[model samples]
Target: METQELHRGRLIDHIQLVVRDLDASRAFYTAVFDVLGVPMGGTADDYFWADELFVSTADSEAAEGKLTGRHHLAFQAQDRAAVEAFHKAALANGGTDNGAPGERPYHPGYYAAFVLDPDGNNIEAVYHGEAKRSAPSVKVAF
Candidate 1:
């Protein structure tokens, strides 16, 4: 079977998090992203990526010789159910709960769930209730 690689040309392009344990981070992300509907795009001895997010070991060049500090990253969810599912999968895969699934104070219609990845980075899944957009996201190829 063949799988398509996700695009990599957003305003942020890509974000990489260098981790202490690549394997543990890998397992944690795999479980959470699965519920969010993103697949593991590719992997190497020291790194792996899914969509625009990349995870690598401290030795990877992308780390620039430093492990990243705690960061808060939020992934968009299609609905409240997906957000709930992401939290469950994360908890089952070595993640610690930061916040349970619920409506947040961020705004009305902002429902989110947060977890701490193995490295203590905040991972979140959020659904903005309902919205209409001209397109799903920016698409570019090179």
Candidate 2:
């Protein structure tokens, strides 16, 4: 097998969103991820990625020309300002506002923003108050 390394969040290893319009999705995600401080992992004619989220055209080999159903994916933000910035950047790049930046009842300091991506997937950026992290993410190699 080919050697590889990955950085992952606590629960999910990665998520692949197969979209009808790869370009539109890429644009939307690029802007949002930029504001969240997540760099694009890599890209190709039909796909792109940032952190653990992979986006692709249905025509991409792995997608087998099948689009995935709408999904709710949330990203962690460093602070409330990042969440607000994520909303603005997403809107300017083909995203629709689902919920503007604000605190939610989910918990104290559960500030977040939600947007519908090019394919209507519910995307969120959240900042759960100030907290410390032992590590940014878990790393795996093979």
Candidate 3:
């Protein structure tokens, strides 16, 4: 089995997204994460993961029941270029364009791109301009 780690520093330790098709979700996420520079953690018969995100099919024990419904999830990108790469990658990997990459009214310098995954999840990549962080993240191995 491939070992992986998750960063722990926020209110939510982790989030599991139950997908209808693990293979499709995996391909979609694999492409997107590659642009974001996040490594694919591991995979099982019914699930696969990347960084802090866990994606499993409804048949997986972790899901317990049904697949997840439409949801909006925005991942932070290092820069606007990364956001553009994310959109291009997602589209090349079975994702539909929800919104083109551009600055939004959400806030100044909030350049972002949006796409719909195989399961219709509204996934986004946003670069909040330049900023300083104390730490990239709190590493937590599992």
Q: In lDDT terms, how accurate is model 3?
A: 0.78
Segments in model 3 whose C-alpha atoms lie over 4 Å from true places: 1-69, 139-142
Tens-digit lDDT track of model 2 for 1-142: 6759989765433466877788888889888988989899665898788877878777776443543346657778888998999999999999988889999875789898878899977678888897778998889987
**What does candidate 3's lDDT look like per residue over 13-105, in tens digits?**
245687777888999999999999999976588878776688887777655454334554778888899899999999999999878999987
* Worst 10 contiguous positions by lDDT, candidate 3: 63-72
Question: When superposed on Cα atoms, how far off is each prediction in RMSD?
Answer: 12.6, 13.6, 13.0
Whole-model lDDT values for every prediction: 0.77, 0.78, 0.78
Report how far residue 72 has shifted in candidate 1, in Å.
0.9
Predicted model with the maximum TM-score:
2
- The estimated TM-scores of all candidates read 0.52, 0.53, 0.52
**Quick one: ranking by lDDT, best first?**
2, 3, 1
List candidate 1 stretches off by more than 4 Å.
1-69
